[model samples]
Target: MINWYPGHMAKAKEKLKENLKVVDVVIELLDARIPFSSRNPKFDSLIGDKKKVIVLNKMDLADKKITDIWVKRLSEEAPTVAINSLNGQRINLMISKVKNLMSDKLNQLKRQGRRKKPIRLMIIGVPNVGKSQLINQLCEYGSVKTGNKPGVTRGQQWIKMRKDLELLDTPGILWPRIDDEEISFKLAATGAVKEELYDSELVGYKLLKVLKDIISDTLEEQFDLSQVNNDTLELMEDIGRRRGCLMSGGKIDRERTGNIILNEFKSGKLGRISLEISSN
Candidate 1:
């Protein structure tokens, strides 16, 4: 599945490059389940020589054990924090980490006898990874509308986070090309792309299969789906039957089955599951 970047994301990419010059630090948000896939490909180079704080967002929806693995893995590359963008949870820790990364920069300015300036940080992430949600949490008292749909943010804007820290929130950017099948599968599985990439039914079935393999009894417990002796398709059919998605001839309605499964997973009804696990 080769994913093409949308026109709107192209403008964000250009703006991201231009805004990099004014940023002293970068805060990149990655989906906790698929950290590598959630990252913007151009991030490292775009942030060159600047301090970075990689935030693994949506932690509540990911496997806690896998999240720990990613936290350790990413910490080796840069300072990493696992946070739930909702409820303003773990955001203060993120603020503290960013302040630490820019400590030297702040001291450098002081050495030059320059007045202290607000810590300038650029926030970047792929669409739907919770960058805007995190920003809204950090600036909850301020006027900002947060949504589940991607691309709600249209242009660049700066918001104050703390006494001496200013955040430049940019529109989320997806890369111009998606060349890896494994990555595409992971992204589609995780709801990163719009629902157009794959059949919703297929995606939902895939989610159930994945859940059966990893969490075992998770699907059965959540959806009241019974454990069946049959194969994956049969199990999906059972789910379809339970949900009353049946064709006129009495066949399971696959399309509705798919939508139900995918929606349930997205809404966290399938439980706190992570699609990807660490190799190490």
Candidate 2:
């Protein structure tokens, strides 16, 4: 079970609600690999009636086919764009999409003689979904500091994106309660949730189990395993032995092996993997 409800997150929740009142649009960044798990459902109710854009980030680290499907499926609700924010891949297209989505709103402002003001935006997402990276790409500078771990952006920072656009960067907000096991595992697996909150062995086992079915070939290639097994524990043992993680009695060092599996998957060392499939 993954239980992570820091009291500080409540403050961030309030901050996002307050920031929404001033911004013209909400640009939500989600991990391309775990779109369903990464999405904070609270956003729909919190940013009510605000123009929203869905950015499927880390596209290169997710399955291209599923990412495409997600873009199409989510675009029905909001203007959606798939991008790898780390390298700014197709980030220009994202900018263009934002402009197009906001054109009607911008035109209304122009008619009211409000054309001189810059476009104000609020970016929110579950932790570690490339929110800061997208901000840097958009601003064309490393404005907001970024890190691999969650809870890195503890405070809100207002960043100017060129002369005509401004952004408010709030701490990434996750729903207070995550009841679904797979959602919990995916969030934990993607490094969106803090590592200390969940057990590494269980998460690694679940991740390995999923990959065993979805992308066994990738696992085989990465670990040089000639044969794969149905049980994640056995698979983990094989991986541990391959990686030379052993103890005095030559037992598989499960802790070290778990960390290795998680780190490799999170860093995309195993290959492009997507945890969620489109329901539609």
Q: In lDDT terms, which candidate is top?
A: 2
| Candidate 2 ranges beyond 4 A from true positions | 111-114, 140-142
| Model 1 misplaced stretches (Cα beyond 4 Å) | 111-113
Candidate 2 collision pairs = none
lDDT on C-alpha atoms for all candidate structures: 0.81, 0.86
Residue 120 shift from truth in candidate 2, angstroms: 0.6
Candidate 2, residues 43-149, lDDT tens digits: the string is: 89999998888999999999999899999999999999999998989887877777786788778888998745677888889888988888887794557788878
What TM-score would each prediction reach against the true structure? 0.93, 0.95
Cα-based lDDT at residue 150, candidate 2: 89
What's model 1's TM-score?
0.93
